[model samples]
Target: MMFRLESVDARQYRHKSKRVGWTMAALLLVFGLAFSQLLVQSFGSSFWLNALGVLLGLLATSLIFAWWRRRPDMAEVRYVTRLKQHLARVSAHLSTLRQASRQGDVRALDLLAFYHQGMAQLETLEGRTMDDDAERLAERLELRKQRQLHGLPEEVAGFDPAELDAFRRSEPRT
Candidate 1:
């Protein structure tokens, strides 16, 4: 026999399952009491009617429980709304990064790298590509780096010896 597992969170599943079980149990208990009254009043003559009533009660309980479980919870609805808003903000930020890089802003390069790293992590989790525009930005940054290295001015001034020493000390050893 094949069993189909639901994809709900474990906590949510446990909570909902417990609630459904309790509801079904209560419904069965009430139906059992009512059926016992009918059986007693009929002098135990309506045997088939009693069995039918029990089956109908079970069917009603199952249908109600299934309907309740199938409805979307408020928490899940709010979560999806927030997720959509966050994705929209990310798209806008990525567009801004692309525009800034296109204008030859060096700071945009660092920002793009940071953003790309974060998107790469998300891509790994989601199993999809999230860097279509990032690839072009990366290429442009590489070209700009090469240009800056080759067009350097001679005798660069304002050398900070302390900062240089600190930076060197912070480097990882090979």
Candidate 2:
């Protein structure tokens, strides 16, 4: 199956959030700093100092917030979030999927995808990126594709306990 970083942290969802945050902060700061521009333009007051202050404040606040992201321990937070999502993904179907995997059923690929993503999430929490196991699996899959999966079902609409178990009972149980 084609997969890439299926297990990413909740933070990945917030990737564009930082830009939005910066834009909002800049807007708020700029609104406040507008007073300086007003002073400079209308009153002919010496607002150069205020202009510098506004510039400095914007840059400094941006840098400070960026650095603060490193201060808190978000490892557990991200892990818990990922765990919840994974649970939601496989909670009802986990056992059936496992049985499917043990039976060498093509439906097992869905199970593998779930685990592959979970591992990736764990790796991310550890300051790691890619799942090496997944890399190897992908490589093997690529090599195996030429041979083709000899007996995949014509239509796999994902796993269901009843559907998978019906076939599981027919297997030799080796």
Candidate 3:
């Protein structure tokens, strides 16, 4: 069975995840401290039990934070996941989407803008900002500068909801 997920805000989710992870780690430390103190008070200086508490707390903190870091909702995964979601909604994959965009299809243009943005983000994640990728840059320039979409901007940095709105309004309804 398939389940639909509400759209995720990758930046917000990541920020919140970091906060929660830190909070959890802090809580573990506090619990360990309290546990150690209690053991010392109840057992007339229990070194081994205190050490065990510290060790367990550290293990839990590491394991939990590692799991949180690996969540699929991270910004890195979101770039690709969101693109796939958009394509799936329109029953198109990367190759077909690219072909449609090349033909100047409206929906394709919208999706292509997202694809380009995702590619750029992926590049940033890979730590290759200074590297000039000739082919990718050329394609973006060709579309944004050369294509005259009657009422749109000459340089579209990313997908614009208003562009679609204007286009839809300009065309007469059947």
Candidate 4:
């Protein structure tokens, strides 16, 4: 099941898997109460023992539910932090790629490898960003892909203005 990690201000929030699990869990309380009632009737004991057992059962169920609810919140924070760190690492690797590509040496192959890795990481991060940030930098990434495509051609010859124009158009404005 897809779980949405919602953010409140800068903090994170997560749905507690709805009340379905809670309802199922409450069955433990129901069974305990029924068992307790049966025991009270069969043993001719005072009502307090059965009542206490039922109360303890309810308390245990409540603690389990509370723990289950907080679980996703903890997981959400970890997931977000890991994503942010991954993005940072990808960005740093891309910078190294740009530098190596500038040198125009055999190391360009290494840069290409890094570029491909960075693109994969960027793709993953794109899915996890805030709504308004979903498509951020995607256009630039497409332009980068187009530039790589153009660079693959061995023939440039004289500077054709049309080809230059097309290349310029494919690149990010800034």
Give the alpha-carbon lDDT of every model.
0.49, 0.51, 0.57, 0.46
**Cα TM-score of candidate 4:** 0.26
Which pairs of residues have clashing backbones in candidate 4?
A: none
Candidates 1 and 2 compared by lDDT, better number: 2
* Tens-digit per-residue lDDT, 1-174, candidate 2: 222233334565345335546665875587547756755677676757577657766666677656654544533344445455554655455556555555556545544444544544555554566645775567336323422454443222322444434545554544
Clashes of each: 0, 0, 0, 0
Instruction: Give the backbone clash total of model 2.
Output: 0
lDDT by residue for model 1 over 1-174, one digit each (tens)?
111111234355345546656878998767766765676577665767777667766777777766765576634323333334433443455555455555664444444443443344334433456457776556546645633654632212222234323433543355
Lowest summed-lDDT stretch of 10 residues in model 4? Answer: 154-163
Error of 2 at 131 (Å): 5.2
Arranged by TM-score with the best first, the candidates are 3, 1, 2, 4
Q: 3 or 4: which has the higher lDDT?
A: 3
| Candidate whose TM-score is highest | 3
TM of each candidate vs. truth: 0.32, 0.28, 0.38, 0.26
- lDDT for predicted candidate 1 compared with the true structure: 0.49
Q: How high is the lDDT of residue 51 in model 3?
A: 89
Per-prediction RMSD in angstroms? Answer: 19.6, 14.4, 11.8, 16.9
The sequence of per-residue lDDT tens digits that candidate 4 reaches over residues 1-174 is 211222322322223223435564776668568767777788767778687667767776777655764575555435444445543543554544454445443233233433344344434443444325545355345435544654643211112224323433443443
Best by lDDT: 3
Per-residue lDDT of candidate 3, residues 5-31 (tens digit): 234455665566467667887968886
lDDT, residue 135, model 1: 66
